[model samples]
Structure formats: structure tokens, C-alpha cells
Target: MTGTATLCTVTAPLTLFAAELGMDEGRIGLLSGIMPFFQALGILSLPVVLRFGSRSVATTALTMRYVFLGLFLIVPFFAARPDAVFGVLMAAMLGFAVCRSLAEAAISPWSQEFMPRSVRGRITGRMALAYVPVALGVSWAIQAWLDGRTGLDRFVPVFAVGIVIGIAGALMLLGLRGGRAADSNAPRRRSLTEPLRDRNFVIYLFASALQSIVFVSISLFLILFFRDRLGMSSGALVLLVALIPVGAAAGNVTAGWFVDRYGTRAIRTALQAGQIGLLLALPLLEPDVPAAGALVPLAFFLFGFLFQAGIAVGTVYMLNVIPPASKEEYTALHYSMDGLAGGLATFAAGFLLAWIGAGEVSVLGVDLGKYEVLFLVAAGLTVISALAYSRLHEEGALSVRDFVGHFTTGNPMKALWGINRYASRTSEDRRRDLAFQFGGVGSLLAKEELIAALRDPSFDVRHEAIRALGHISAHPAVLNALETVLEYDGLVELRYAALGSLGRLKATSCAPRIAQFMEDPNPLLRARAARSLGEIGDLSSLPRIRTMLHDDPDLDCRLAATSALGKLKDRASMPGLVDLYLEQASDRTNRVAEPRSKVVLLAITKIFRCEEEFSHQWRREEVQSGLAMPQILLQLAGRVRTGAPGASAKLRELTSDYNAEDTAATLAALAELLPALHQSRHRDSDLAVDVLNEVRTAAEPHPALLVAMAAILNRIFAA
Candidate 1:
């Protein structure tokens, strides 16, 4: 359709062909006006779409459009006279227009049904991008072919190629998953005129129609401004025309990102205002003058860009405003009105040209003419449209300042930096309050101030200060402050924040102190202590967490302990968790068992990746034979929280071969793995056989291997 539409535009072979046929400007206007006239009747075509469903109607229309395009190619070959050729051309165009109108009516509603609202702007922008290169290639190909050739003969091969490409597009549509079932038997919920009863929708309808007039005016006359007013060469005109699609393509890319993230109301306002500005500038510049020729392509580019951006955002905005149940009816009405306005606008441009003439006129000492008057009038209508658009509301829209910030920077990280700086300077809070805000922003510059804020007279300030410090992660100063807060701060919230921050910072040295908090009188404090211990990843803290999970009277504290054990990923907690589950389940009246069961399920899921157990097992076995096994070996060693092999003389000899860190890690891994291996033997898991085989082979008198073997056996069977 795009390739074929290009051929029929006012700038194209149709314009020259009309001239060759000696058709007057009024007749040429009527020719360019054909599509929208039928498209304005697009609402009347809705029954065809609803009857067969949008998918079927759209596909059939696209197919028949190509059939008409084939006739367009062959018509010129048969008709020798200008009258016959003109008649056939008009007939072909009418057929194409009617088919396209049905498709246009179907596709918008079809797109709305399937496309997610969150990313609609992005997808629309990408669709515009896809159109750009094709439009450019077709424009270049047609222009280059017609450079030296005259008459209708040049279009034959172009139309033939268009038919082929259009067929490919049609075939591609056949594969689309027409999302919803065609509910032909569904009862009508409301009359078609019901949407017009919506006052806001009526205002939107007027705004859309007004904008459509200006858009059509620019598209119909921009080439004439370059050709008649500026005297640009055909070659220059061809190249300048390509700039329109390029700019529109670029607009889609940015417009989508802005619309999806920031909402569409601001984007629509800005683009409409931009269009008005560009239109107002049209009368002041003369491309024929020195240094002004450059503005012609730029004006055309901005024109296309603004048109596409406004339409893209407006379409998204319309979807947002319309009731979901009546989307198809409302959308069809909107397009019908838009098409009517565009058709009238095209005829009005021609009528003004014929009636008022293109001769120069002056107003307010400004050099203006008929084209200039047209531009000014269009700008006036766009102003009204812009005002009307502003009346509509959208949810989650960014403030104007933030929208401009996003527009200029185009990166969220940079936007956050800007926001942080603004919050730092503009906030009315005192230094301590400002420090708290900076902590939310994760501003490293506030580190010293946040550390100082920890000593503020107010406990609230100290609580926030600890939290902020945790977000920055612990430095030596932060760790010291947290320790001081835990030891001296009388407030429970402050103490909880301090423990949490220590765990988040992975302050390994603080683990013992955090462990002692598990015995605090407050069950909440005990829960926090258990969680922090797990976060610190200290194996020695396992005994405290295990005791809390099993013996704590408070269910919340026990649940937290269960979570901590899961984080530790030790098999040693399995027996205790199973016992806890059975104890809770035994009481039919216990409401707490459900949540506790979820916690146990979660722990087991985390330990084994229940969803991907086979995959993990495969990866682990693969890693055992590879160079990366040492890292896994160290992690396994770290899991050996509670039980250990008493140093068998054999195990001590093997321990002598490794560095302190590696030996400790291996011992932890073995302690954890040993209990898991014992359970695996009952289930007849392959891991049990592998572990037994490894032990038997290593039990040889080679002292180092024997020591390793004994470490495994002693950890497995020891109480």
C-alpha cells in the first residue's frame, strides 16, 4: 500500500500524468482527494469488518488492493488515448482507495486488541521505522527511473514491482495469529452513536479533525512550495523528499520511548505546538534566496517528523481515553471524522488555489501570498487543536520539567543524577533530613554526613542514618558506627537497622554480635538477628539459626529462621524443618501452618532448584571435571555450618596439603555434602553411589587421599 500510495500522491507520477492529460488544477485536486472521500465512509464499512471479523476483512482488503494495483499496471499498457488512460487510472485508484479504506478501518482496532498498552508506543514507533526504508527505497527507485523518461511508460515496471512486494506483505499477514475469536454470535451491547454522547470524546474528535486539516495541507502542498516558489531542480526535490521519511523514522524512535515511559499527553502537545511553529515559519522563508535553500529540506523533515510523532502518540492517547468495550466503534468514528476533515482540507486547498489564486499578497508589511495564507490558516487550526488536546487527561504523566529532562538526556541514569542534584539543592530539610533523602538517592557524597547523622540527638534521625549507611554499603567507618549503635543505642528500631545494615554490608566480623541478638527478649529482634546472620553467610552462625527455627515460641521468628537457613543452603536444617512442618501440621486448628509450609517449600526449592533440579545436577557434574570445580568446592565447604569430622590422622594429613582458606572451605563443603549424601543413599540417588565410590577409592594408604576419605566418612556418620 505504501509503495502504491507513493505513486498516487500529489508529488508523484499522478501529478505529472494529470498535467499530461491536460486536466485542470481543480480536477487534479479531485484526483488527490479520492482516497479520503472513500475513507471518510470508513465507518460505513464497519459492518463488513464486524461481520467477518477484523482479521478476515483486513487480509481480504489487502489482497484485493494488490489486485487493483495489478489493474493499475496493465491499464496504461492498453489505453493509447489520454482520456481512456485517465479513466482507467481513476477507476484503479478508486478500487485501491475503497479496499484500503476497509483495511484502515479493520487494522486500527485489530492492533489495539493484541498490542500491550505498556509498550504500544514503542511498537508503533518501530512500525514507523519499518515503513521508512521501504518508502525511501520506493521514492528513490521511482524518481531515478523517471529522471529522463517521460510519459506513463515509466510507471509500468514500478507498479509491477509494487504488486510483488504488496503480495509478500499480504502473505505475511496470513501468518498473523488473529488474537481473539470472531464472536459473530455475540449480542450488540450498545448503539454506534453511544460514544458521541461522551463529552470528552467529542472534544477529542474535534481536536483530531482540526489537526488532520493541517497535516493534509502540508503533505499536499510542501512539494509545490519547493517546485513553484523555490525553483528547485527535480534531482534536488527527489533527495529532499527522502528527508521526510528519514525524519519521521527518527521521530518514531524517540517518541515511543517518551510515550511509554512518560505518557502521551505532553508529547502530543509539544509536537502540535512544534507543527504550528513550523507552519508559521513557512511564510517567512524563501528557499530561492541565498542560504535559505537549506531550510526547505529541513522544513520538510520536521514536517514529516512532527506528523508521525503526533499521530503515534495521539493513537496511544486515544486508546487510553476510549472505553475498552467500545474501542472498535469509537476508533472507527474517530478515523471517519479524521478522514472527512482531511478530504475537505485537500479540496479546500485546491478550491483556495483556484478561487483566490496563488498571486502574492501582503499583510502587516509581511511578504505573504496564497500559499502563505494557507499555511497561516492551518497554523491557526492547529492552535485550536493544541488547546483542545490539552483538555484531555492521562494517568502517570511526567511533569513538564521531567519530560524535558528525559527528552534532553535520553538516559535514566543521567536523569537520576539530575534528580539527585536537584533534591540535594532544592530540598528545605535540615542537613540530617537532607542526609536521609540523599541515602534514598544512594549519593556517595553524603557518606560522611550520613555517618555523622548516626549520632543525631533524635533516634528517628539515627534510624534513618543507619538505613542510608546500609544502602551505601559498609565502609570501615560505617561498620564502626553500626557496632556503636548496636552496643549503645537504646532504641530497638535503630538496633534492628544496624544489624540489617551490617548483614547487607557483609561485615563478617559483626556476625558473632548479631548472633547474640537472637536471644533478645523481643521476638522481632530475634527474627532480624537470624536474617542478618544468614546475610553475613557465616557458617558458625548456623547453630543459632537452627535453634531459633526449632525452639522459638514466636512463629514469626521461626519463619525468619527458616528463611535464613534457606539462604545458607545447608542440608543440616532439613531434618529440623521437616520436624517443624510435622509439628505444625499435627494441629488441625493451627492457621500458621500454611505460611510455614510455604516457607519450607521455598527453602527446599532454593536448595535444589526444584524446577531445574536435573539441569543443576548436570551442570554440577560437568563442573566437577573442569577447572571451575575449585569455586564450587569452596562454596560446598562454606555450607558445612554445624557438623564436622574430628581430625582423623588421615584427614589431618590431607588438610596439610591445602592452604588455610581452601582447607576451611573444603571442610565446610564436605560437612554440608556429607548429610545430603546420607539422605541420597535412602532415595537411591546417583550422587550417593558417586560419593561412596569416591570414598572407597581415596581410602588407599596414600596419606593425603586417605585423609580426604576419612574427612568425608567421619562427617557423614558423626553425630
Candidate 2:
């Protein structure tokens, strides 16, 4: 249909052939209206189509359109009689139009019944992809053949090729699924006015009517304008006009996805706004100007882009708006009325041109010619159409106000791209990507997609969805969704992700609820809760976190508590931080160096405003090896907090001795010593150091921890 439609319908070959038959722009415009006017009568054939079966009816009609097209080959035989040629051309084209419309009317219901809804968009998109290039290739060949031709003979070859291609496309339709014959007893039919009873659909029809008129007439007339005003050859005209389909093809790439994300109304309204601008520009492409002619290709490209994109989005809108029971009737009426409008407008435009005459009229110093006036009026109607369509209700559609933001800030298009890719993916990795895409965008559309993603059975996808909800904190539902996961979700990872996201959102309302998770047996959940409290700035949870810092059985929980204290920046937690340092530094049970040692030290250093001085000192090997050193420094911090200045000479001696100790050997020193210090600390450090060296040389292998216990008891005695 695409390849044949270009040459055999209201396109370059047909219009040029009509012009060659001595038809003016007025008569050519009337000729362009022929197909659509006949299309308005297509609903009359619906009962027959439905009874015989849609595929069969569509296939038969499609084959017959070519039979009518074959008459164009006979048109050149009557070149001697102008009267015979015009009558023959009109009659053949009228038959061609009726058959084409019958094919369209039947194909819709045939597809609706045959194709599964899930794959319809994909199948049609693939069809468009497969046919557009073939159409372009065929049109290009015709352009090359018709480049320097004259008379009706030039169209004969083009028509012959169109007939062959059109018949082949028709025959291929027989292989499609479903389209079985309806029952012998037909069901009672509803009134055609059923769709008209829908107030919103009626509103939609009004906007669609105006849009159809402008879109249909503009493309048909641009060819005539090029020929009459620019002296462009038929071949050059066809080549330049072919960009419309190319642009339309490009537009379909994103149009359906946008309709899915942003909804049909918003996408359609925006496309109409673009069409209005394109229409206004058409009037400016005046004759005898190089710049005007240079812009012709671009103008047609935009025309095709907006035209096809609008139709693509409009199809989705109609499907969503119309009920299934009356799908065929609603569809038929929409096409008939929209085509009727376009047909009438095209015929009227020709009469308008004939009425306006060739001479220019000036108003406010701007010259207005017939084509310019026609285009400008079309632009004006389109503006009104854009405004009207903006108000039509489509459930889940983006409002014009926020849809405008898609141009400035949103990922509606990017989300659509991800969704399109996501639909075909089998792997969790591929499917999980769409969940992550919603994180940075504030679009509620993205938020909705992310919410749906949460229900995805794949843990990775749901986990990412929970994480993404954290980034979009504007909506109350975002907080609610995150909290729901934190409270009831059985997946520990998803709950953990939810907790982290809640903190990222700074959801203080969820903070108290989060604090309860501090006691969760899952160490990751406990750590995450403490971390979220810090992130949420839940100062009331500071006491509990400090307790976690001192008493959490898990090393990771303790490190998390230490990091949380750093984030909270609470001066009152200094004693707990000091105790944490003292505990890690002196424990002997923990054999390997862990992040706990460095994390606690960093927290104490942060409270002291010395993190910059200590930042480079927290590497794993370096921090654990210097545990005794930080242990001494935390002792100094305690004295400083108690209003005592450290003695510089003693500090230097301790630092030098600590640097001389074997780092790997002393990694367990704090592990041995600090556990015993929970009981008490020795004031006499000299005696303890001597006992530690003696125990190191003992042949009986006395544990350093037992010796440290003895030192703690001695401190208790001293006390």
C-alpha cells in the first residue's frame, strides 16, 4: 500500500498526470479529495465485510484497487480526446478510491480480531519498518523514470508498477491469522451514533477533523506549488516530497513509546503544535526565492514527521478511548469523518485558490498570495485544533503543562526507549535496566513505571525499583511505597534497599519506624537502619545508635554505627566513639584487622575536627597496624574533652614507640587488651607494659589477653 499509494493516490505521479491533462490547481485539489470522499462511504460496506470475513473482504478489495489502477495504463490511449481522458481518469480513480477504502475498513477489524493486543504495536511497527524502505526505493525508481517525461505516457509505466506491487500486497493478506467468518445469524447492530454519544471522543473528532484537513491538503498542494511557482520538474518534485515518508518513518521510531509513557493526548497535542509551526512556515516559502526552495525539503520532512507521528499517537488514543464492543463502528466513524473533513477541505482549498485568484493582496505590509493565504488559514485552524485537543481527557496522559517539561527536563522519551528495549529482554540484567532508568527522572510517568517494576518477580528488578523510588521523593506515594517495602517485604535485600532509599530521601517520618529495625537479627538490616537514622538526621535515634556503636555483636553493625556517628556529627557521642576505639584497639579475639578500627578512629577524629589530618591514615593495613597509636590518641581526646592539655614530650615518646612495633604482630594487641578494659583501665601503664613483655617471652605460652585481664584487675585494685 505504501509504495503504490505514493504513485497511484494523491501523490506526485497522480497530481502531475492530472496537471498534464490540463487540470488546474483547483481541479487537482478536487482530484486529491477523491479517495478520502469515497473513504467516508466505507462504513456502508462494513456489514458485508464482517459477514464474509474481514481478511477475505480486505484481500478482495485490495486486489480490485489494482484492477482499477490498471485503467491508468489505458488512459494514454485516449490522448487525442481531452474529454474522454478526464472522464476515464476520474472514473478509474473513483473505483480505485472505493476499493482502497473498503480494504482499509475491513483490515482494521481483521487486525483487531486476528492480532493479539500484546504484539499488535510491535507487529505493525515491524511492518512499517519493512515497507517504508521498499516504498522509498520504488518511488525513487519512478522518480528516475519520470524525471524528464511528458504527457500521459509517463504515468503509464508508473501505474503499471503500482498495479503489480499493490496486487502482491493484497495477496499476502490472505496468509494472516483469524478473520474467520462471523456466525450465520448476525447479531443486532448498534446505532452508528454510539461513538458520537461519547462527549470526549466527539471533542477528539473535532480536533482530528481540523488536523486531518491541514495534514491532507498541505502535502497535496505543496506539489502543485512547487510545479507552478518554482518551475520544479515532476521528478525533482517527487524526490523532494519523498522526504515526508522518510521523516514519518523516523517519527514512528519514538511515537508509540511516547504515547505509552506520556499518554496519547499529550503526545498528540504536542505534535499538533509542531504542525502549526510547520504550516506557518509553508506560507513563507514564497516563489522566486532560493532560501524558500532550500527549505522545501525540510518543510516536507517535518510535514511527514508530524503527520505520521500524529496518526501513530492518534491510533493509540482511539483504542484507549473507544470501548471494545463498538470498536469497529467507532473506528469506521473516526476514519470516515476525519477523511470526510480532509476531503472536503482539499476540495475547498482548490475552490479557495480559484476564488482568491493569482494576484497578491497586502495587509499590514505583508503580501498574501493564494497559496500563502491557504497555508496561513490552515495554520490558524491548526492552532485552534491544538488548543482544543489539549483539553480532551485521556486517562494517564500527561497534562500540557507538564508535557511541556518533556522538552525541557524529563526522560519521558528515554523511559520509552528503555521500556521498548525491556519488553524483548529475557535476562534479569536486561530487564533490571528499566528500573534503574526511573531513578533520576522526576516524571510521575516514570514513577508509575517504577511502581509497576516493583511487582516484577525478578528480585534484581524489584531491588532496583526500590532503590529508584528513593531518588523520586517528591510524591507522598514514593515515601509510602518505600515504607511499605521496609515494613512488610520479605526480601531482605529489597527491605535493605528500601531502608537505604528512605534515608536518601531524608524521610524523617519513616525514621522512627526505621529505628525499630536496629534490633533486627539480620546484621545488614541493623546496619542499614543505623545508617538511615544518620541519613534522616534522626537525632532522637542518636542514643540507640551510640548503643549500637558500643554493644552490637556484629563487627559490620559496629562499623555502621561508627559511620553513622560521623554522619550525625553529634558532639555528645564522643565518649561512645572513644569507647569504640578503645574496645577495637584492645580486643584480642578478633584476629584479622577490620574496617571497625579505622571507622571508629575516623569518627573520633571527625568530632575533634582532625579528619583532614587523619584522612590518609585510615587504609586497612595502616589503620590496624596503628591501632595502639589511635588508642593513645583517643585517650588524649578524652583528656582534652575533660579540659586537660596533653603533655607534648610524653605524646612524642608514645608515637615513636608505637611506630617501632611490628604492625602485623600488634594487629591483635587491642583485640587482646580492650575486652579486659571493659572491667577497668590501669592507671599505672609502666607495670602493664613490663608484664606484657614478660608474657611475650614466657615458655608456658601465657595468652596476652589473660595478662591484660590481670592488668584490668590491678586497675580495679588501684581504684
* Best-performing candidate as measured by TM-score: 2
Give the alpha-carbon lDDT of every model.
0.67, 0.70
How would you encode candidate 1's per-residue C-alpha lDDT over 620-658 as one tens digit per residue? 434543233343333333333333333222234333454
Which stretches of candidate 2 lie above 4 Å from their native place?
A: 74-85, 180-187, 260-262, 286-295, 361-365, 395-490, 505-523, 533-719
Query: Model 1, which residues run further than 4 Å from truth?
Result: 1-11, 19-22, 74-86, 179-181, 233-236, 362-367, 399-719
Give the Å shift of residue 403 in candidate 2: 5.5
Cα RMSD, each candidate: 22.0, 10.1
TM-score of each: 0.57, 0.70
| Highest lDDT scorer | 2
Query: In model 1, how large is the Cα lDDT of residue 439?
Result: 65
